[model samples]
Target: MKKQLHLLRQLVQQAVTHSDNTTSIVTDSFAVNQAGDLLMIKDVMIDYLQNLSFSKKPEVFIKRKILHTQRECITLLDMLPRTKMATPDQVALADQMRKCLDELLRHLHQHNCYFSCEVNAPYIEIQRITDKTFQKMTVMKAALKRKKIYSELLNIICAAFDRFHLSQQHTYQHLQYMSALQLSILKLCEKASDLDFDYQLIEHLTYWCFNECHFVDYCKSLIKKALKPHYGTKQCYEQLCHFEKRLTVQQEKANLRYSVQRNSVKYQLMVFVQAELECIEKKQQYHSGGKGVTLKHTAQIGSYRVQTSFSVAALAYFMKLLCESGIIQAEPRSQLLAFIAHHFQTPRIGEQELSASSLATKYKQVTPRTAHAMKAKLKELCQRIDDDFGSGD
Candidate 1:
């Protein structure tokens, strides 16, 4: 963890120096490169802190290290030269770095180590079940029929739901455990489906299940309700703050316990799922202008009329393919559909024009199997064209 932090510090130094060297008239590429550097540093620091929180070190030792690391990050950030005339992009980048540092400090100051032996016992038991279920998933992946695999996965998920219900205390650690189990179930589903399923879709479904079952939100509401009586009192404020600290500590301890089995398949699956989710979040932020950077959208071709006949489903599927392949980057599904509707003659049912909502619904319903088949067909066609045309050359 220290090594990772050291690497993060170096990245900060490099980024700061690069920004300091910027000319008065900054080129677009230079600004982008600088933003990328800061973003990389932020990601590295976050991963480092997560790893530290999950280490098997003593609580006192971990807390001390966190404080020190937080200070170091703040000091490095202070070195970033600030100017009154700084561009909005530069200001946004600096604000992002500062926000990351603030979160790190909050993690250090919060405490969450209030679990008694009786309370802790349930978590241990759940951990055991998680490990056992994960092992069963690994062993049965190749041998079990898809139906059996689905049954086993559903059983484990149901068991998690049951355990969550039986618990008297709805601590944050319990929610974390439930979340980890959900990710494991998603992995099992992906494996059973021979990786033909849309991971994002499965992730959305799993989270939706949690919401529909009222598991996560209920637990959070319970905690908040316990603190509700103290709303305006100073004593209440202090008590609530203390509780938050303890919650943070307890959550880290839970992470540490899970990290003991970090080499397990389930653990790797959790990591992969988290990384993919983060990637999706970053992409959304980039497209939505959350990074405080202004991007020019320029068209390479002049407007032209297009006469095409295709069902909404076909058009939606093609748009999805293009976005997933990086050929297009229209986000929010609606934006992409709107672009297509504007430029092409879209098919419509008798009275209604092709609606963005309808197209988005079809987009979600498009199966991965169909997408892959279409992609393969396109590749084969391209190969044939290349082969036939190469003879003339």
Candidate 2:
């Protein structure tokens, strides 16, 4: 046994040296460089011999197998991209390699130590022993048909796990078990399916392998934002700010354009009203200057309401315009004063029926000339408001 241990140490020391020296491990025909490296690597595999202990030798090989198998798997996966789109032959070759690995793993596990796998749900840990519980759970998932026999398999596997497991605090954790061996085995089966193997093996093997490895966390910490594809590139955030500024500038330009267009339309309407007013003035002068004879007329119909509605409706909107056009003067109380002068003077603008109380009292405060001046001003202001505003700004 001492001789075998010494031989194992020598093999490990040599293989580590060779791995350090070699640049590549494969050739066109087969592996020509790792031949010497492989021999040294194989010599260190102590679990392959039949006389090895279930207690001691299995643990040593477990550590070495973990390291060696990892290196070999990486080497093969790397070679895949170099091979032109995978052929059936290439897929077969990859499967053959993995199967060889599985056989080796089973052989090494033959002498592994045991612990009590017998227990109920919410598994009770026995002596902090083997990962038999995890393994059993993983395997039971794959074997739905023979659930009754699974309990016995669980106990046997647990006994082996107890002997192999090391303390969590121990510096050497080579035999330390994983928490989710089932998940790792599931992932492994997925990998095998990619190599064109039958899927049936994965479902069953995953159950058994669940007793072996741990499930690693594979989630990302951040949630990705859903943005335009351009946002994914560098410098896009700064460009987005610039685009926002340009949109604001365009909106301001549109508002200014609308205001200018509105003012031009008002100027045209005012010109038409002025021309019509000029024609009315010329016609009125012609009629008044020529009339010397009295003309017979009929009695007016509904004459009582004439001045009230006329003065307020026609003059209310136009009075303010006339005031602003220099046709009249603007002053406080000018609108009420204008109504008094016009109604009292010409066309007897309104009926005498309205108690002159409100108009008379207001007119008493101002002289006749002041009253006439204010009346003209009110009319001009009314005209200006009509031309400039829909409601007046």
- Return the top candidate by TM-score: 1
Give me the displacement of residue 150 in model 1, in angstroms.
21
Q: Model 2 compared with the native: what TM-score? A: 0.17
By lDDT, the best candidate is: 1
What TM-score goes with each of the models? 0.25, 0.17
Error of 2 at 222 (Å): 38
lDDT of 2 by residue, 179-198 (tens): 33334434554453221122
Clashes of each: 8, 36
